[model samples]
Target chain A: MLKEILYYTWGAVVSFVLAFSVGITYMGLNRKVTARVQNRIGPPWYQNFLDVIKLGSKKTAIHHGVMHHLGPAFLMVSSVMSLLIIPILNNGRFYPNLNFHGDLIFLLYIMTFGPLGMALGAGQTGNPNSAIGVTRGLAQMAGFEIPWVMALVALMIQYKTTSIVDLMNIQAETGRWLMFSSPFAFIAAIMAMFGMFRYSPFDIVGAPSELASGPMSENGGKYLFTMMSSGSVFAFAKLTLYTDLFLGGADNLLVLVLKTFVLYMIPVLYGVVNPRYRTEQAVRWFWGWPSFFGLLAILQASFF
Target chain B: MINDKESQKIVDIIQNFARKHSLWVLAYGTGCGAIEIPPTMTSRYDAERLGVRGAATPRQADVLLITGYLTTKTLKRVIRVYEQMQDPKYVIGFGSCTINGGMYFDSYNTIKALDRYLPVDVYINGCMPRPEAVLKGFAKLQELIQAGKADGSKKYKENLEWYRANQKEVIPVWRMPEFNW
Candidate 1:
């Protein structure tokens, strides 16, 4: 009984450390890359850590009763738990790694929980501001996700397996990244995915200027810290997942960093060019034609 | 004496330490003013040099800068978030919206002045201010931080009676879900 407790405790500690470090580091780099693209000297690489520390220690003011408090927690818990199922690699290489399939589709869907819970939590506060933020969030989720998910389906069709291991092996044998093998589907999914990341123009929901941090307005102290840390970790996790999926060719950490940063930059650049989408206009843009485009990409992958 | 208020003081001190250095904006894309926040803080304008950033959650924000007009529909959410923020929190009214309602000042649906409901410190003027102007606001905030002000906590400690009554009388946005005035 003691042994079992020790084992579980040890696993929890290590998982937290790994996820926390990797998550913070990647977001630091993301800040830097985003900084370069936007033409400014962004915060120190350790800024996310500093930010979380501040949040964790602050005075927690709970707003709108219970839902606001619960929402940030719900959003955070689901994201941190996802680490358990993910295969943490010792290095970026596919062969010598502790990789697991991590129920990839589950990871994607559950990740949505953090944002959705946040949206609902904000809504329940009876914050009309958050209600509007929720409306915009729902629309953006619809627009980009259709293409992103459809592309994932296309990739699944090609691989014949959903397992991460199988994905890597298939790539190694074929010597092709999905980006190279099926550029359109890959690009569509990535474009949509990055758009969903809310790096820039896609930041239609949670308009800080408008909604006052949207749903998170009422959350303070450790509750707020958890949300912030989870988000930072989530950002890094996203880059890691995308790196493994597309840029696995580089042999070393430095090379991997270069490729990953390049990929990370694509969306940050989008921040420079576009402005926030009006909620109605954003929904309309996705409704009729873009969904059709995603369908086309899936078809092209299958036929061509 | 770890009374609820005293324990809160220690926590408040640490939170302020964290708050002064790194500020983040929430994921909310509520108003057009959000568009300008990113570039000022990202690589393009790099708001980081001044230690200003757009965070994804309120837990991370020190200054809840309200940039645009708040409608009856949105004010409740804003007040709730303002409540969620840790004490010693600083609020910046970024444009006309939070001050006198800006363009929406006379609108039947919008709140007249944010201060009618919540407390505020700094104000950045513009419909949608330029990145430079936004950063200037950041710089002003930083200067206050350097002076050890870090946005006061008085509003939180002020006798509750005034605000409770004011919330009811002035900012009816506090009453229920949405009451079109």
Candidate 2:
């Protein structure tokens, strides 16, 4: 029992580190790519590392209450928990902390756990912008989760499994990636992903121009640092989850990075040229074509 | 073999280096100089390459860039914003107006100088400093940070009463929160 516990703990740590580093690097590359598109030389790839360090070192003054303190903590917990649950590699190769059957449903619920926790914290701050931002964030989550769930449910029905690992295994056995098999589900999920990533046209939650970063308007220094790191970790975990589900799980780290980076670019590049959408517009957008694709996926899964 | 003092110095150096590279500017654009900022941040100049980015709120900001003229009316808000910022913060007085009021020097509403009201670390002199000048100001501020010379926040803390007095003299209705620090 002791050995198993130690091994799990070690694996958890390794996965957390890997997720964090990859997430931060991806964010840096996102900035670089955005800059290149605009015909400008961007900051170094490690600019985020320096920013995080600087934020961590700075001191925070004035807290609204205990919830304000716990807000970032809650976000961190959600990110790390999701990271642990998601299989970093196929068949428990490097670190299989917790990849159990029916984990898909659990993963779905746990993913939004952080934002709800954040809303509570933002409420405690008494900042109107934070409240506005939190509402927008939750509303956007509601908008995206419809198609996201539909896509997942379609997969579950098609493969007759609710386990992400099992689905991945099925894909490997058949030598057919799920994207090609359930193209509509892939389309719906990718559309939901645009909102999930909170890139252009969907970034109203933290509209810095109008909302002062919305939910995080009051957060600074160490609080901001924790949020930033958690965001990076969460981004990596989400990318990895998508990779495992649709892209046939990678055998090694190199393949994993390549696949994840390609998936990440879909949203990052899309965000660069497009302008932002209002909250209602963004929500309506997901409910429109994405939801239609999701329904199609379900129909295809059920019959064919 | 490092003593406590030696180790402390090493930590300070690292902190300063990180802080220097990442300067989140709260551009308190109080004047025409604010126009130059967009160009500086955009494709042509790209201030971000130096790790200088615009921050939305005073809370997340490291440098308070006072772009252009500060009138008696705007000074109160500026002070409030400055106080709201978390420490180890720096202030950049942009344009000649911030330094000595420039064209607004003769105007009764405009404050002749900014340093009397707030600690100015680096002053960029121009009636309306261009994007290039703004980048130069940032580079100067970075250099000051590296040398451990930028201590505007410390100065504000140590001489709070003096700064408050100056602030009160300019504005008649002084109903601002007390600077606890």
Q: lDDT per residue, candidate 1, A6-63, as tens digits?
A: 7656665675565577667666766776666556666677777776776665554555
Top-scoring candidate (lDDT): 2
Please, what are the lDDT tens digits per residue for candidate 1 over residues B63-129? Answer: 7877787776677677666655555577787777778888876788787777767776667888888
Q: What stretches of model 1 exceed 4 Å from their correct place? A: A1-18, A21-41, A90-102, A249-256, A284-293, B1-17, B23-48, B52-85, B90-181
Query: Which tens-of-lDDT digit does each residue in A47-88 have in candidate 2?
Result: 999898899999656668999989999999999999988887
Evaluated on CA atoms against the true complex, candidate 1 attains a DockQ of: 0.32
Best by TM-score: 2
Q: After superposition, how far is residue A29 of candidate 1 from its true place, in Å?
A: 5.1
